[model samples]
Target: MSGTLRFLLASWKVNLASALEYRLSFFLLAGMMFVNNTIWLFFWYLFFARFPVVSGWEIGDVMLLWAVSAGGFGWASVLFGNFPRIATIVSSGQLDVYLSQPKPVLLNMLTSRMSVTGAGDFAFGLIVFLWAGDLTPRGCLLFACALLLAGVLFIGVMAIAGSLAFWIGNAEGIASQVFGGFISLTIYPTGIFRGAAKVILFTVVPAGFIGYMPIGLMREFDPGFAAAAFCAAAIFSACGALLFRVGLARYASGNAMTMRN
Candidate 1:
């Protein structure tokens, strides 16, 4: 466990160094994403200005929603940066080199790169939290928990979508759509979604669990919802792992040169 953790740290160090090589570009990308998110918030501000609340959600709730959504995605992208690209990697036969390595293929592929824009996302989350969220110790802890569950949900769902490449060739489009839909769903309050839509949010996509956390768990501290959220994350992660491992059996090699360790 310690060795794996050390390797992950080393990989992050190397990624940071590489990102630093083009410091200006990195900062520009991160900064641009931050600004982009802020612009969306401004639009929300306009809406709220006209109508003070939507489905019991005020500006502060929306702010926390963005924080959890972006922060969770930020950490996932920064750490396991390859979650959304798994289908492309698998379909393109790029897993060949990773398969030959002594380490875990999934871990190796995930940590191999860092997302420069994700730094801005992470920063935006913290900044929003400081500005809008409660700063008490318990609130901070719950917020952290929300981030963890959100990150896990993002990675797990994306991985499951990507692993479909083993059965269907070039599943990138489907994965991309899922990614888009999940991101869109997470930003809105779950209350706005009704009946079947709400059910699908929790079951089919599981975005509701994430979208609900800011209200049910983090802001209000509902034990049942908190437990449900944790279990959902675990289930998604397990399912993703199972699918990826099963799919690995079907991996086919390509023309790319690969070194065997």
Candidate 2:
């Protein structure tokens, strides 16, 4: 366990160094992503200004929602960048390189890359949290827990979606669509949706686990719901790992030459 943790830390360090090698490009990409999130928040701000509340959610709730969602996503992407690109890697036989490594294939694959824009998303989340989220001791603690749960859930869902490549041959398109929809759903207040749509968010896409975190976990502290959300994240993560293992057995090798640093 210690060895694996060491490897993970080393991988992150290497990724950071590589990203810093091209500082100007890194800063530009991160900056653009931060601005992009701000613009979306601005639109939401305008809507809330006209109507102070939407389905019981105020702008403050939405701000924390983005904070948890974006912050969670950013940390996951920065640490395990390949979570979103598993389909492409599997379909292209990129698993060959990971298979050759002494480390666990999934862990190695996840840590092999880093996303520059993720830094922007992470920073944006922190800024938003400071601007609009609860600042009490309990509020901060709950928010931290919410961020962790959100990150775990995101990685788990992406892993499952990406593992489909082993069966479908080219599941990249499907994975992309699922990921896009998941992110889109997470920013909005779950209360806005009625019966079926609401059910779908919790069961099918599971975005409700994240969308409702601000209210259920941070703002009000619903113990029952928080427990459910925690279980949901754990279940999704375990399911993803199981699916990837099943799929890896059928992975095929390719003749294309490749190298990794």
**In terms of lDDT, which candidate is strongest?**
2
Q: For model 2, how does the per-residue alpha-carbon lDDT over 126-206 read when each residue is reduced to its tens digit?
A: 899988887888778888899899999999999999999989999999999999999999999999999999998888788
Model 1 lDDT tens row, 107-206? 8888887888988899899999999998999999999999999999999999899999999978999999999999999998898999999999999899
TM-score of each: 0.97, 0.98
Model 1 residue pairs with clashes: none
Best by TM-score: 2
Off by over 4 Å in 1: 256-261
Give the Cα lDDT of each candidate.
0.90, 0.91
Clash number by candidate, in order? 0, 0
